[model samples]
Target: MRIVDRAGASTAGCILHGAVLLASLDGGRVYLLNGPAGSAIAVYRLARELSAFDFPRGLGR
Candidate 1:
Protein backbone atom coordinates (compact mmCIF):
# COMPACT_ATOMS: atom_id res chain seq x y z
CA MET A 1 0.00 0.00 0.00
CA ARG A 2 1.09 3.60 -0.61
CA ILE A 3 1.29 6.04 2.29
CA VAL A 4 -0.15 9.51 1.84
CA ASP A 5 -0.02 12.84 3.64
CA ARG A 6 -3.04 14.90 4.66
CA ALA A 7 -2.52 16.93 1.50
CA GLY A 8 -2.55 13.68 -0.45
CA ALA A 9 1.18 13.68 -0.92
CA SER A 10 2.69 10.37 -1.82
CA THR A 11 4.28 9.05 1.36
CA ALA A 12 4.64 5.56 0.01
CA GLY A 13 8.40 6.01 0.29
CA CYS A 14 7.96 5.90 4.07
CA ILE A 15 6.77 2.32 4.04
CA LEU A 16 10.09 0.84 5.06
CA HIS A 17 9.14 -2.79 5.54
CA GLY A 18 6.42 -5.01 4.31
CA ALA A 19 5.95 -6.11 7.93
CA VAL A 20 5.22 -2.57 9.25
CA LEU A 21 4.63 -3.72 12.83
CA LEU A 22 3.59 -0.18 13.79
CA ALA A 23 3.32 3.18 12.15
CA SER A 24 2.01 6.66 12.92
CA LEU A 25 2.06 10.14 11.46
CA ASP A 26 3.21 13.05 13.60
CA GLY A 27 2.30 16.19 11.70
CA GLY A 28 4.79 16.43 8.90
CA ARG A 29 6.73 13.52 10.31
CA VAL A 30 5.79 9.91 9.80
CA TYR A 31 6.77 7.74 12.74
CA LEU A 32 7.31 4.06 12.27
CA LEU A 33 7.52 2.71 15.78
CA ASN A 34 8.64 -0.89 15.19
CA GLY A 35 9.70 -2.82 12.14
CA PRO A 36 12.52 -4.98 10.75
CA ALA A 37 15.97 -3.44 10.40
CA GLY A 38 15.69 -3.89 6.66
CA SER A 39 13.00 -1.24 6.85
CA ALA A 40 15.78 1.35 7.00
CA ILE A 41 15.52 1.51 3.25
CA ALA A 42 12.11 3.13 3.57
CA VAL A 43 13.30 5.43 6.38
CA TYR A 44 15.71 7.30 4.16
CA ARG A 45 13.25 7.23 1.33
CA LEU A 46 10.67 8.80 3.63
CA ALA A 47 13.17 11.33 4.87
CA ARG A 48 13.61 12.54 1.35
CA GLU A 49 9.88 12.83 0.79
CA LEU A 50 9.06 14.30 4.21
CA SER A 51 11.82 16.85 3.90
CA ALA A 52 9.49 18.82 1.65
CA PHE A 53 7.00 19.17 4.47
CA ASP A 54 7.24 20.80 7.90
CA PHE A 55 7.20 17.70 10.09
CA PRO A 56 5.40 17.56 13.39
CA ARG A 57 3.40 20.62 12.45
CA GLY A 58 0.09 18.93 13.22
CA LEU A 59 -1.02 15.89 15.31
CA GLY A 60 -0.16 18.04 18.36
CA ARG A 61 3.43 16.82 18.73
Candidate 2:
Protein backbone atom coordinates (compact mmCIF):
# COMPACT_ATOMS: atom_id res chain seq x y z
CA MET A 1 0.00 0.00 0.00
CA ARG A 2 1.12 3.51 -0.80
CA ILE A 3 1.15 4.91 2.66
CA VAL A 4 0.18 8.51 2.13
CA ASP A 5 -0.29 10.87 5.02
CA ARG A 6 -1.83 14.02 3.59
CA ALA A 7 -2.37 15.88 6.82
CA GLY A 8 -0.22 17.40 9.54
CA ALA A 9 3.08 19.22 9.24
CA SER A 10 4.50 18.73 5.74
CA THR A 11 7.30 21.25 5.60
CA ALA A 12 11.02 20.62 5.08
CA GLY A 13 11.88 21.94 8.50
CA CYS A 14 9.15 19.87 10.12
CA ILE A 15 10.22 16.78 8.22
CA LEU A 16 13.86 17.15 9.20
CA HIS A 17 12.96 17.76 12.78
CA GLY A 18 10.65 14.79 12.75
CA ALA A 19 13.41 12.56 11.39
CA VAL A 20 15.76 13.72 14.09
CA LEU A 21 13.13 13.13 16.69
CA LEU A 22 12.27 9.65 15.45
CA ALA A 23 15.92 8.69 15.06
CA SER A 24 16.40 9.55 18.68
CA LEU A 25 13.81 6.92 19.49
CA ASP A 26 16.18 4.16 18.50
CA GLY A 27 15.74 1.86 21.48
CA GLY A 28 12.10 0.85 21.42
CA ARG A 29 10.63 3.32 23.82
CA VAL A 30 7.10 4.53 24.30
CA TYR A 31 6.91 7.48 21.92
CA LEU A 32 4.18 9.70 23.11
CA LEU A 33 2.02 10.75 20.20
CA ASN A 34 3.17 14.31 19.87
CA GLY A 35 1.67 15.24 16.50
CA PRO A 36 -0.62 14.12 13.74
CA ALA A 37 -0.07 11.72 10.82
CA GLY A 38 1.69 14.32 8.67
CA SER A 39 4.26 14.87 11.36
CA ALA A 40 4.93 11.15 11.40
CA ILE A 41 4.96 10.81 7.62
CA ALA A 42 7.47 13.62 7.33
CA VAL A 43 10.21 11.32 8.51
CA TYR A 44 9.05 8.38 6.46
CA ARG A 45 8.88 10.51 3.33
CA LEU A 46 12.31 11.90 4.00
CA ALA A 47 13.65 8.40 4.43
CA ARG A 48 12.23 7.32 1.08
CA GLU A 49 13.53 10.42 -0.65
CA LEU A 50 17.00 9.78 0.69
CA SER A 51 16.85 6.10 -0.25
CA ALA A 52 18.78 5.24 2.90
CA PHE A 53 16.34 4.76 5.64
CA ASP A 54 15.19 1.75 7.62
CA PHE A 55 12.97 1.46 10.65
CA PRO A 56 15.11 -0.55 13.02
CA ARG A 57 13.58 -3.85 13.98
CA GLY A 58 11.96 -4.16 17.38
CA LEU A 59 10.87 -0.56 17.18
CA GLY A 60 7.31 0.00 18.41
CA ARG A 61 6.98 -3.78 18.50
Candidate 3:
Protein backbone atom coordinates (compact mmCIF):
# COMPACT_ATOMS: atom_id res chain seq x y z
CA MET A 1 0.00 0.00 0.00
CA ARG A 2 1.14 3.55 -0.69
CA ILE A 3 2.01 5.68 2.32
CA VAL A 4 2.06 8.87 0.29
CA ASP A 5 1.55 10.03 -3.28
CA ARG A 6 3.53 12.99 -4.50
CA ALA A 7 4.94 11.67 -7.74
CA GLY A 8 1.37 11.67 -9.07
CA ALA A 9 2.01 7.93 -9.51
CA SER A 10 -1.27 6.07 -9.60
CA THR A 11 0.57 3.01 -8.32
CA ALA A 12 -0.50 1.12 -5.26
CA GLY A 13 2.12 -0.97 -3.19
CA CYS A 14 5.92 -0.66 -3.42
CA ILE A 15 8.72 -1.20 -5.94
CA LEU A 16 10.96 -3.41 -3.71
CA HIS A 17 13.93 -1.21 -4.45
CA GLY A 18 16.90 -1.25 -2.03
CA ALA A 19 15.47 -3.58 0.56
CA VAL A 20 16.74 -4.85 3.95
CA LEU A 21 16.06 -7.69 6.35
CA LEU A 22 14.84 -6.31 9.64
CA ALA A 23 15.22 -8.25 12.87
CA SER A 24 12.13 -10.19 13.82
CA LEU A 25 9.71 -8.14 15.85
CA ASP A 26 6.77 -9.12 18.02
CA GLY A 27 5.26 -10.67 14.91
CA GLY A 28 1.88 -10.12 16.48
CA ARG A 29 1.94 -6.57 15.16
CA VAL A 30 2.35 -4.92 11.82
CA TYR A 31 4.75 -2.06 12.17
CA LEU A 32 4.88 0.72 9.60
CA LEU A 33 7.91 2.90 9.82
CA ASN A 34 9.31 4.87 6.92
CA GLY A 35 12.04 7.48 6.52
CA PRO A 36 15.47 8.01 5.01
CA ALA A 37 13.90 8.47 1.61
CA GLY A 38 11.75 5.43 2.14
CA SER A 39 14.58 3.35 3.56
CA ALA A 40 12.15 1.68 5.88
CA ILE A 41 10.52 0.21 2.83
CA ALA A 42 13.65 -1.89 2.40
CA VAL A 43 12.34 -4.87 4.29
CA TYR A 44 9.04 -5.46 2.59
CA ARG A 45 10.00 -3.14 -0.18
CA LEU A 46 12.49 -5.55 -1.78
CA ALA A 47 9.88 -8.23 -1.38
CA ARG A 48 6.52 -6.56 -1.94
CA GLU A 49 8.14 -3.70 -3.77
CA LEU A 50 6.92 -1.02 -1.37
CA SER A 51 7.92 2.58 -1.99
CA ALA A 52 7.74 6.08 -0.54
CA PHE A 53 10.17 7.60 -2.99
CA ASP A 54 7.46 9.71 -4.60
CA PHE A 55 6.27 10.96 -1.24
CA PRO A 56 8.08 13.48 0.97
CA ARG A 57 10.38 11.65 3.39
CA GLY A 58 10.06 12.50 7.07
CA LEU A 59 11.53 11.66 10.53
CA GLY A 60 14.81 13.18 11.62
CA ARG A 61 18.07 11.29 12.05
Candidate 4:
Protein backbone atom coordinates (compact mmCIF):
# COMPACT_ATOMS: atom_id res chain seq x y z
CA MET A 1 0.00 0.00 0.00
CA ARG A 2 0.94 3.64 -0.40
CA ILE A 3 0.82 6.38 2.20
CA VAL A 4 0.88 10.02 1.19
CA ASP A 5 1.28 13.25 3.01
CA ARG A 6 -0.60 16.48 2.48
CA ALA A 7 2.39 17.95 0.72
CA GLY A 8 2.03 15.44 -2.13
CA ALA A 9 4.82 13.16 -0.96
CA SER A 10 4.34 9.41 -0.76
CA THR A 11 5.87 6.08 0.23
CA ALA A 12 5.06 2.62 -0.99
CA GLY A 13 5.55 -0.63 0.85
CA CYS A 14 3.81 -3.84 1.79
CA ILE A 15 2.61 -5.06 5.16
CA LEU A 16 3.87 -8.57 5.14
CA HIS A 17 2.25 -9.61 8.40
CA GLY A 18 0.79 -6.91 10.54
CA ALA A 19 -2.06 -4.64 11.36
CA VAL A 20 -1.63 -1.15 10.03
CA LEU A 21 -3.06 2.05 11.38
CA LEU A 22 -2.99 5.34 9.51
CA ALA A 23 -3.80 8.79 10.75
CA SER A 24 -3.45 12.29 9.42
CA LEU A 25 -2.53 14.86 11.97
CA ASP A 26 -2.20 18.62 11.99
CA GLY A 27 0.27 20.20 9.59
CA GLY A 28 1.24 18.31 6.46
CA ARG A 29 2.13 15.15 8.33
CA VAL A 30 0.91 11.59 8.33
CA TYR A 31 1.44 8.76 10.77
CA LEU A 32 1.72 5.09 9.99
CA LEU A 33 1.63 2.51 12.72
CA ASN A 34 2.51 -1.10 12.17
CA GLY A 35 1.70 -3.69 14.80
CA PRO A 36 2.84 -7.23 14.39
CA ALA A 37 1.51 -9.38 17.21
CA GLY A 38 4.60 -10.25 19.30
CA SER A 39 7.04 -8.11 17.43
CA ALA A 40 7.82 -4.46 18.01
CA ILE A 41 5.40 -1.79 16.95
CA ALA A 42 6.69 0.54 14.27
CA VAL A 43 5.74 4.14 13.77
CA TYR A 44 6.63 5.90 10.55
CA ARG A 45 6.54 9.46 9.31
CA LEU A 46 5.05 9.53 5.91
CA ALA A 47 6.89 11.07 2.93
CA ARG A 48 10.20 11.11 4.72
CA GLU A 49 11.50 8.38 2.48
CA LEU A 50 10.23 5.83 0.05
CA SER A 51 10.74 2.11 0.26
CA ALA A 52 13.95 1.03 -1.39
CA PHE A 53 12.44 -2.21 -2.45
CA ASP A 54 8.78 -2.91 -2.08
CA PHE A 55 9.11 -6.69 -2.14
CA PRO A 56 12.00 -8.83 -3.23
CA ARG A 57 11.86 -12.37 -4.50
CA GLY A 58 9.51 -14.36 -2.27
CA LEU A 59 9.40 -11.79 0.45
CA GLY A 60 6.13 -10.28 1.62
CA ARG A 61 4.25 -13.18 0.10
* Model 1: CA > 4 A from native: 1-37, 58-61
C-alpha local distance difference test of each model: 0.41, 0.38, 0.31, 0.34
Angstrom error at residue 60, model 1: 9.1
| TM-score of every model versus the real structure | 0.28, 0.29, 0.20, 0.27
Worst 10 residues of 3 by lDDT: 20-29
Q: Which is the better candidate, 1 or 2, if ranked by TM-score?
A: 2
Ranking by lDDT: 1, 2, 4, 3
Local distance difference test, candidate 3: 0.31
lDDT of 3 at 29: 16
Give the range where candidate 4 is weakest over 10 consecutive residues by summed lDDT. 17-26
Residue range 1-61, candidate 4, lDDT tens digits: 4455566776644443111222332233233344344222233332122242322432333
lDDT of 1 at 14: 37
Query: Which candidate comes out best when scored by TM-score?
Result: 2
Report the poorest 10 consecutive residues by lDDT, candidate 2: 1-10
Q: Which residue pairs show backbone clashes in model 1?
A: 28-55, 28-56
